[model samples]
Target chain A: MTASRENSSSFRNHTLTVLAIVLLFLFLWWADGSMAEDLGLSFLPEGLNGYEVQILNLVAVYGILAISLNIIYGFTGMFSLGHAGFMAIGAYVSALCVLTPDQKEMMWIIDEILPSLAALHTPFWFSVILGGLVATVFALLIGIPVLRLGGDYLGIATLGFSEIIRVLIVNATPITNGSLGIKGIPCHTDLFTSFIWLLVVVFCTVRLLSSNFGNVLKAVRDDEIAAQVMGINVFHTKLFSFCLGAFLAGVGGALLGNLLTTIDPKMFTFLLTYNILMIVVAGGLGSISGSIIGSVIITVLLEWLRVVEEPLNLGFVEIPGIPGMRMVVFSVCLLVIILYRREGIMGMREITWDGIAAFLSRFGRKKENRA
Target chain B: MSLELFLQHFFNALTLGSLYGLIAIGYTMVYGILRLINFAHGDILMLGAYFVFYGTTLFCLPWPVAVVVAILGSAGLGVLMDKIAYRPLRDAPRISALISAIAVSFFLESLAVVVFTGLPRPVHQPEWLVSIITIGGARLMPLTLLVPGVTAILVAALLYVVYHTKPGLAMQAISKDIETTRMLGVSVDKIIALAFAIGSALAAASGIMWALRYPQINPYMGVFPGFKAFIAAVFGGIGSIQGAVIGGLMLGFIEIMAVAFFPELSGYRDAFAFILLVVVLLVKPTGLFGEKQKEKI
Candidate 1:
């Protein structure tokens, strides 16, 4: 193909991909709405109730979070266990921002609310962005020091920072309402808001990964010393990715708080980060598409596994619920996957239009041969 | 503060430091050989406590016998963890092993929750162990003094093994270069398993002591102390046993003293360790006893 013709064809492919994604989103939205209402949609998958819709919202939020973590841990090769801390910051800041004055007063029971915070309230969208920005600032401050360390040291430091943040949030009652946590915040995150944010995050992350900056990060992940020798300002690149990841994690947290309509210091524990880490690792490190795929699969899998934890009544007998069985199963799955398929499902490969086209063409050729 | 109060704080710091040091040694040894952060090291500590809990409560064993059983059981579990989770990934990318370590950690924690439940349970100490003693107008439990004494003894034993024994030499050689050690016909796997056994045995000892001191045992009890111990290991310089001990002591002192000085910020005591870590890492990443790692081109 000529250069111009190739460019035009690629542009068309891009448009088609975007349109397809949009259509998928619309279909999902319609289906979700119907499921929530228990309206007739016999041809579709079983409709989700209000509770299920909430779970689906969590999936989208986690999808954004998992992808953002992928940028830091997967792409940049920084093993951070501090994403929860960033999420906590976003959750509290955004939750506080959107809370009405009365709600703030009602929530801050332990101590008198700070006057400045008491007076301030941002729109939901603005609060979410602000939450992300604040988290980015914290990440930048933290990354400057911790990013210099390699491997497990970085993970420890970040994990420690997260614990510190949680502790601080518990103690800083004036601003965060201490450990009592903010309750009854406006529920602004629906399927539309969450899906839109995921789309934006996925788009930007893909673009960034394709850029020179992304290449530098991949190089850093592959071999830090070589990247350093190749004149990459390794620390700056790492810090940038770390901060960006923190920003998205912050946004995800904000959405999560809104979705749950509550926020607490205990909610953003190390386990929260562990879950996100599981998603990133299981999705395939350094793959954005893998993060999304992993996020949805793990999210659904986790929810589905709740069955083993709940009491079951069969005609023959009744099985008692085992409270921790779900986690046992999940952890076993993680161990098996890591041991056997360390690269996870994607193995750093994104599902691209060209690849899909090539795969389909090969299938078509096989069918033609059979005919 | 009065002299008695100061002394009390000093004793508190010592006991806490000793526990940290004991746990840090395990992390130091594992990191020394495998260069993989055994995230499950803390869980092993929890297992030690649980094992004793079961031994004493269910089997009606004496405290000392229960303690020994806990240590030995924990060592066995540690070796098993190495065989099942870590040994296979020895040649894979470092991160894969690290992730596997995390999986093992999560698996152990969840399994603990399954078997033991998540509720915090009290571990009973013998009356003599909890007996209060007064020295220089400062009141202290015998357990307080015993913890540090036990830690010191264990450290000495570890030093003796690392410095004088054949297995110790093998451990050192393996840590220096696993491939070369293998080439030299040393049983690298055995040495690595030995490291886990010793490391986990220490974790068990400390866990039992921790249970006695705190009187509460839970599935997640190991998480925070485990993290703090890792910090201690890093602060002292990873891969250096002596460094881990020194680091543990220093962290204990910092945590105790910070809370002592600022009663208002007592809630932020955990934050102090991390702040210290970031400062040490930024100023000197190798830690106090750690040699700087040089990557060859």
Candidate 2:
């Protein structure tokens, strides 16, 4: 009887938690839409502008990227700097699929796009999936060979592959339109679509991490020889984590390209990979929810940090804006976090409902005493 | 390609490859001792170039004096980096050190951007270094010969120091086993710092030459050649100085010759090193002269 009672309460908590999240997402969706004024959200004064909405979308995209990286580097203990490459693959493939032949013709001013590729067109959702699948396939191909290497060697090898991939994209002018890049992509990515993808990614990754396979990944990470002794297929596990990370990274790239409506080969540089790595590290390497929170904070923090890049004035004095000052500050933050506070906010722990409730109750009691 | 064109390309390869070797030596020496890839080594090269640029233009120093000062400054910075960024994480997970290195790399690059400005500056090449000389109907920049000659002298001097000096033995011993070397009463930290100093100095030399070759200087310019040099180090053997030079020269040949022979594929020039890296990794994971993998147990 007590077991049943506990189950019911836990199920109720889960339902309440999910409902709360859904409601929050719905509010954001409505506020981001044009009809927000009609709903009498006068408190907001003005509904979110394009910049605000774009930041929100960026949060979702980065959330996906962080989680993907968390799986490859965090739980699996493989230091991969390949997110940019995988994302590039996903971005280009999805863009190609969704562009109409007319759009393709207009975009490929350098060289006419391949005749076979010109007619390709798929629904937005299908194209995103195709982007992810292509990335996954490419990941599989590289992962098979590279996974044999471990630690820093693997990182360097992956970085090399990512660079090679970018070079290929640049040279394949007939396909990727060379350096001109794809422009005027239909802006199919908004907060709702991107957040839904983020939810799906989080759900899947959380499930995978909790499964027996998750234990296997940890075992491999902690000690490869020990995992091998325990009859684990170490290579296969690393490959699976790598491919999953690549797939999500690809999807995130697809959304990012749509959100921006343009992508040049240069856009997918090592800096992008480093940014996601920073997010994963700052969010707490092994925490899923930490990635979400990290992405939100980082996405906002990046935009907020733009203030440092702008010219400053103190009534009597003025300081010219430093072009790369923000990145300097950003990299300094990452260095500090890695050195002094590597566990980050979550420290490999997940956010739980009871933990939240307990904090709230303690706060309420404190207020009562003060009164 | 005509014989003259071929000779010119060969000399170009020799110049580029030796510079790669010079830079790669720093990578190998540091990796040998610390088991860490100094991601900022490339940035150190950039700093080397900038320091020289400033020393000559901003400070009005002579070219040779500028080279010496730049090399010293970069070496000091490298040692400083080791003290501030990497030393604290000596006992932390290996990944922490690697991450710290990456962070330092980014920090230096971004810091360069902020301080130096993001614009690529034209490096004023000295007429003496860049003057073209025709020998037997083959015209070549003096640097095409000078870079290799300087690199050989420096490398030979380095090999002498590493192989013949007492501190050199300590460095080798440290690479073999840090704890054992410590037990033998060697100061590991001092040796490590020495390695960084030497590595940075050599990298500075390469950077100055690289600037001479390209005639342009920028904050972020060290990234590509740095990575390629790292690859050359790996190809030669991560811990072997001789291997790194040989590997670098081989890479330089492959890159220049491939472009020279196949003009159509010049666009893929950067891809060659990465491809070589992957191929080397698959075929000989330890590189040409890297030590065999030994399980600690």
- Distance from true position, residue B159, model 2, in Å? 0.8
Output the worst ten-in-a-row residue range by lDDT, candidate 1 chain A. Answer: A34-43
lDDT values, one for every candidate: 0.92, 0.91
The weakest ten consecutive residues by lDDT in model 1 chain B span B261-270
Error of 2 at B190 (Å): 1.3
For all predicted structures, in order, the TM-scores are 0.97, 0.97
Clashing pairs in 2: none
Error in Å for residue A363 of model 1 = 0.5
| RMSD in order of candidates | 2.0, 1.8
DockQ of each: 0.84, 0.83
Q: After superposition, how far is residue A315 of candidate 2 from its true place, in Å?
A: 2.5
Instruction: For model 1, name the residue pairs that clash.
Output: none
State the lDDT of candidate 1 residue by residue for B1-297, as single tens digits.
899999999999999999999999999999988998899999999999999999999999998898898999999999999999999999898888988988899999999999999999988888998789999999999988999999999999999999999999999998899899999999899999999999999999999999999999999899888989998998999999999999999999999988887798788888888888889888888899998889767
